[model samples]
Target: MSEVAFRLFAERGFDNTTVEQIAAAAGLSRTTFFRYFGTKEELVLGRVGEFGREIADALAARPAGERPWEALRRAFDVIAEPRPGETGAPMDIIRLLSDACALMTRQWEKTQGWQSMLVPEISRRLGGPGPATDMRAGALVAAAISCLDAATDAWTAGGGVVSLADLTDQAMGVLREPGDVPG
Candidate 1:
């Protein structure tokens, strides 16, 4: 199903690919497709809720002494790493997202959701939520997501010459630097 979705997304663009088309391409009924994915965006994003949960779990598992931001940074590094059997080229996916406002909005919402889920875990790790802990968690998660987005955009614009890790590091550097403007 994902393979079909990826090919259709690649060929026709994400916004142009209908759920019915994806379903037909996959030799499944529309009902079956809906059963598998709640929406066309889900077909493209593909189990992102699961990935977010995994990220949260990873953040929760970090060493007790590590700062919440550090734990999240480490967790993000691991999440951003390419794994076996992932569908669609990262650059292509990034480009598709950049070109689609709806996808970009969805991506932003997903990032926010991930961050929200991470906050309690981070607060727990910090032994409780205070103004400082809350602020740090929000800032760290926001910075990480911003960096990931910028890195993806840079990688796409560079014709995929730069690895996602490199882009991520660049994003992290921008975040760490004092007085850097938000992109």
Candidate 2:
């Protein structure tokens, strides 16, 4: 369903594609499509909940002694790793997102939601909460997401020569620096 929708959107442009058209192209009835994905936005947005759950699980599985930021970085590394047979979907998704503001907004919202869900889990993994725990969690999530966004933007802007991991690390390095470093 998602693959069909992405293809249709790429071919017809987002505004020109309709739910019905996506349904027909995917060989699914309108009711079936609705049952699977509630709205046109969802068709373009894809399975956000599933991906969030996967990231949450990955974070949870990290060793208890791992720093929250480190664990989150590893989780992102896991996410950015290319799958066995997948070719260019990640780059294509980045392009589609760059071309559509609404889709980009939805993607940001999804990332924020996932970060919120992971915070408490990260807190727990780091042992009992302290006075600064919540603040630290929020900051860690924000920094990790900022890294991902910068990485994606840099990769897209560079015509995809630089790896997402490299850009992500560059973003991470900014945060890892001592407080005295000049901007």
The residue ranges of model 1 lying beyond 4 angstroms of the native Cα positions read: 88-95, 130-133, 177-183
Pick the TM-score winner.
2
Model 2, 57-130: lDDT tens per residue? 88888887766767787777655655554422554566677777778888888777787777777657545364
Clashes of each: 0, 0
Output the worst ten-in-a-row residue range by lDDT, candidate 2.
82-91
Q: Candidate 1 at residue 123, lDDT?
A: 60
TM-score of each: 0.77, 0.80
The sequence of per-residue lDDT tens digits that candidate 1 reaches over residues 1-183 is: 888988888899888989999999999999999898899887656545556777788887888787665677667755466666666644455667777777778876776778777777766665556534576556667777777777777877787687777778777776565434221
Off by over 4 Å in 2: 10-12, 84-91, 130-133, 178-183
**Residue pairs in collision within model 1:** none
Report every candidate's CA lDDT: 0.71, 0.72
